[model samples]
Target: MFRFALSLTLALLATQATAAEAEPRWMVTTTGGAFARDNDQAHSFGSLAVTRKIGRGYVSASVTRFGSAVRQVDVTLPSTYTIGFLSAGAVHGAWFYDGYVSLGRQHYKSVVTDLGERDVAGFSHSPVYGAGGDLGAVRWIGRSWSVTPSASLQWIKSRALRGQIGPRGGSEFETRETGVTLGAGLRVDKFFGASHGDSVSLRLTRFQTTNASAALSSGMRGAFNPSAQSGRTSDAWAEVGASATWRVDHRLYLDVGAVRTLGALGGDMTTGSAGARLLF
Candidate 1:
């Protein structure tokens, strides 16, 4: 899955490169964020990306590190995720499209507590891969206002045992999940500030699992036993978010964003992010 996405991205870069008529512009961005669930699970992450301008679009690559200490009731799951992404987007008249491919791995340490720690034999790190794309249209209300309606599709496949301590310390269990997410949203944007270069946006989106399944197997000694189960599950979320970008100068920009979600799967989730971008 990741290989296909990478290949497509490279091909796009090649095509864009051939059509270029002038020197390309570039931007570097660094972002950091924290995510929290109402149930007390939390994680923070940071990322860096370099993007190149090509005609009406851009191509970029980024890497992100999600820090450790995703907590559970009786145990603390100290795990780290390192993900790399390839993304490309372009604007065509009033319409725009973009997509991304992500490849990552989750590394987990042994289950730990205040008293002691235990290693679950036969447990190892897992590979993660996913791809997502969105298409939207822009409608200008005036010189400084615009509205956009968009739809998106995303797919992911990965293991889910990184933050789980299982039924027992060495009980030996593994879970695999494959899911497809569908989203639709409307966004409104307004440009403000003296130069009108600083802008803010408000968005409302709904995302639901269209096709999702999870398989679990459990037993000691790496056995495939009767306890295994595979089934389909449905989950949905409604999210509202606001984000703003401040153009400090011609070469630098700052961004801040916050989001709130109402969902059935993990209760309500709140996420906040801040970032800076430098143009060259």
Candidate 2:
């Protein structure tokens, strides 16, 4: 009887402590990470996100930047591509939901030594947009730490533009591409240290894209090969990645993640990122 009373007292104290550790009404985060592939050049990724409370839900806006290297025909340099989006979401108990639409410009940067040692060119450029939603739930089930599972889907469209650079000037050849992506993931979070709010979260995800393109739409057929046909082509690929996040303080956090893709019509690609987060 005495032990039972002690357990009840401890449970009430734990509940009161959790209630005192308030969740943020507004927050912002930024993360940046590097990417590497088995046989390809490296890429860089970064994002900035903002969130605010709204009637049991939250409104969010985010901007993302990614830089990648592509096969060079005539001195093609690498440049960062960008995306910006707005999202609406709700978090109730252990479940959360979010929907967002994003738009961005795609670009491949390159230098044209033939035109001028300092000349730069861009190819296979396009404007891209996508809409996506994510749903997830956390289940503690009487454990010290909780686990969350999430799933997401999105549709994307890109306007393809092929670029050529020479002694004369640069030109763009235009085309189009469309695809859809599906993803599922799980995350585990554990809190340590004297402050139960200090936590570490690890997530793993698998994603697949349909109607992906093997190569950028080049305006011209393979180097004087009249028999070659040039148009839109699509394929598919799958990728998996893991990420970790650490709470530095009540208002600060840090994160890192890595991903690797396979069956990418061209070659396998790997990506990585790390960033800091803030809550208010």
Candidate 3:
């Protein structure tokens, strides 16, 4: 019994020493991607994220931007959108969880502008915000490959301002909507190299949303009156994507991902992304 206890104590000390030597307590990543839908124009997006380890968890801040142009008959519309995010998350054993909040804006060129102003269209703007949580687990099947399944839920709200030039000179309308989205997905990862290996991943996801918009007595949405819109609507969507990460060294990796989103108002969308991560 005495010998066994001493051996156990030595083993515990060795484990502690190994963990203390692990590299990378902080990381930064940036990603860029583009999406195109059927009968609609293509849009490009990019994001930057900074993350740091804290105890058993991590905290991150991110910013994202999107740009696009759409053509309607002889009129052309161009727009820009942006999002800012902050997240706190943890990976414990085989399970991980991420909780985040995001603030964003959407700007789109108005196709409803006056006929004479078709060459220089008016613009509509929407301010959006959301809070969400993600949960997942990593399960390794062998030494070089693993799989993860995840589920996420989020609440998003958007208030849009539409402006156009009219016979009255100019007019604006305000519309507000809220959405609760739920998603579930699975990913498979394959790893190469001996230490801090390069990896590739594939994923598929399905989602559903319950949406509500405020409508007015005129049957229009987003009225200043409290009772204008008291009801809500819903929708469902799905997506599939693949990504790969190439490890440049112990503290850097390059990333790429492509995904297709389905069941949105316009149609299905295909998007591709590339990025890099640095650890220190």
- On TM-score, the candidate that comes out on top is 1
lDDT of 3 by residue, 110-166 (tens): 444435443233445668687777777777787667777888777777654434447
Screening candidate 1 with a backbone cut-off below 3 angstroms (N, C-alpha, C), the clashing residue pairs are none
Per-residue lDDT tens digits for candidate 1, residues 31-120, read 777766575556676778888877777788988776444344555656566878788887777777888887888677777766678775
The weakest ten consecutive residues by lDDT in model 1 span 216-225
Instruction: Give each model's whole-structure lDDT.
Output: 0.60, 0.52, 0.57
In candidate 1, stretches whose alpha carbon ends up further than 4 angstroms from where it belongs are 1-24, 67-78, 112-116, 162-169, 210-232
The C-alpha TM-scores of every prediction are: 0.78, 0.71, 0.75
Higher-scoring candidate on lDDT, 1 or 2: 1
Q: Which model is ahead, 2 or 3, in terms of TM-score?
A: 3
| Residue pairs that clash (backbone atoms under 3 angstroms), model 3 | 215-228, 215-229
lDDT of 1 at 278: 73
Tell me the number of clashing residue pairs for each predicted model. Answer: 0, 7, 2
Q: Give the candidates in order of lDDT, highest first.
A: 1, 3, 2
Instruction: Tell me the tens digit of each residue's lDDT in model 2 across 16-67.
Output: 2445567566667666655554665555566677777665577778777766
> Is 1 or 3 the stronger prediction by TM-score?
1
